[model samples]
Target: MRLSTVILPVRRWSEGGRDQWLRAESLGFHTAYTYDHLSWRSFREKTWFGAVPTLTAAAAVTSRLRLGTLVTSPNFRHPVTLAKELITLDDVSGGRVTLGIGAGGNGFDATTLGQEPWTPRERADHFGEFVPLLDRLLSEDSVSYDGTHYSAVEARNIPGCVQRPRLPFAVAATGPRGLKLAARHGQAWVTTGDPKLFEAGTPEQSLEAIAGQIGKLGAACEEIGRDVEELDKILLTGFTPDRGRPLESLDAFVDFAGRHFVLGITEIVVHAPIADSDFAADEKVFEQIATEGLAQLAG
Candidate 1:
């Protein structure tokens, strides 16, 4: 299974963020990501940088590792504007960029934009329009369209993406509508499973919950007449804090990876041990994962 890590942009941009990404690449990570959020959870008061620029910088320095946002939502970004940025990032990364997108959540990103809270149905409808418009913008030139939530007026993508047609999209989903959207449009489907099940549960319990979620995704693919095997399933490890002990050691990570593999996850992205702003501590964890965890996998 391919391995990745989500480096949260909760810290200051100047504080070794670039160095940490560089270290991750040198240490054999397949891809590295930063969270796409304006302000996240309890870290709202903290310094947070934009995911696009952070990932762009990561792509500039790393040649081997693929770069992406953990997930970008349409809450605060226009699809047309984002498409232009993503294609440029794909070019700069030499086709090593993936767009991890979602229907957005009721978080600080939503309310802070001075937008009203949308109902679940409204969010799904918005996502339906958002993903397709982005697909057209990157794949076709001089696209003009109008939709309920977004519109593009004769938008010309003079030079298209390096990845051809468009860069890869890793779509995050859990609900039926979201799952179907992922099945229809995503190169990869990403999930963190049910939050309630993970809260105060063991690793084994979390695995079971994730398995159910994966099954739902498979069902969604079948309903849409899509081959489930053709889409990559990405499991987000340690996504919920209350999911018992975090996989901090190589053995822990290997065990987690093995379980996910058995559950049909082709890729797993682990969160680094929260080192706050300490890049050295973060680098140590990444180095060990490369040397020990990946070595264990290889062996």
Candidate 2:
């Protein structure tokens, strides 16, 4: 599987954001991404640490790595305004941005921000219409269209998105309907979890289950005439391990997770130890595993 880079817990690790982002380039990660946060407003906040500016700063410093908000919910951003920001960032990244979008999920994001959340059905419907509007605004000069949730007059957006007509649009999905919706609209899917979540079986069997579910998603894409192979379906297995083990156990987990990740996603971003753990043994174990694992895999 391809190895993409990620920066996680962005909500908590705001201080080290740029320094570590610059560090990822040397670590041989293909992309640097962070989760979107719009809520949890403390008494004070800085705007630069938010998702888009973080990406912009990362883009300015790095020449090779890709950049994007791992995702930002559309509910937080109106389509036209988001399209503008994405276009500007795409220019900054020189077309390396992967614009991941979704219907709102966390109620904290909505209720706390006073941005009323949508039902699952509403999210699905909004998701369907969201991408098409993005497609229209970025590519066409005039987008005179109307949908249940949004409408746009036949007006041109000056200086549209950077990656040609259809930029890299990924859907953040977990459930069946969401997956199907991802197939129909997303150029890729972003998922996060640990590999132990799967069953005990041959790696091939595990891969088959993942591929089967993805095949269903791909079939849905086929109905819409989008090529399945072209889509970058990826698993975000943040391989969070507990303690030290022999190289054999670490190797097995890394390779096994890599196989399933390949079957499911175009890339896998290893979730390494964060170094603030209580037990030094656990830290050492996961560090040994991640270090050896990346050494072998990146090789």
- Show model 1 residue runs off by greater than 4 Å: 11-14, 240-246, 276-285
Residue 236 shift from truth in candidate 2, angstroms: 1.2
lDDT over C-alpha atoms for residue 85 of model 2:
75
Per-model TM-score on C-alpha atoms: 0.92, 0.77
Which residue pairs clash within candidate 2? Answer: 233-265, 234-265, 244-285
Across 129-189, the per-residue lDDT of candidate 2 in tens digits comes to: 7777876777765677777877887756767767777568777775667677687667788
Overall lDDT per candidate, in order of appearance: 0.80, 0.64
* Candidate 1: residue 211 Cα off by (Å): 1.6
Model 1, range 38-151, lDDT digits (tens) per residue? 988866787788999888888888899999987998888888898889988999899999899998889988888788978878888888899989989999877999887888
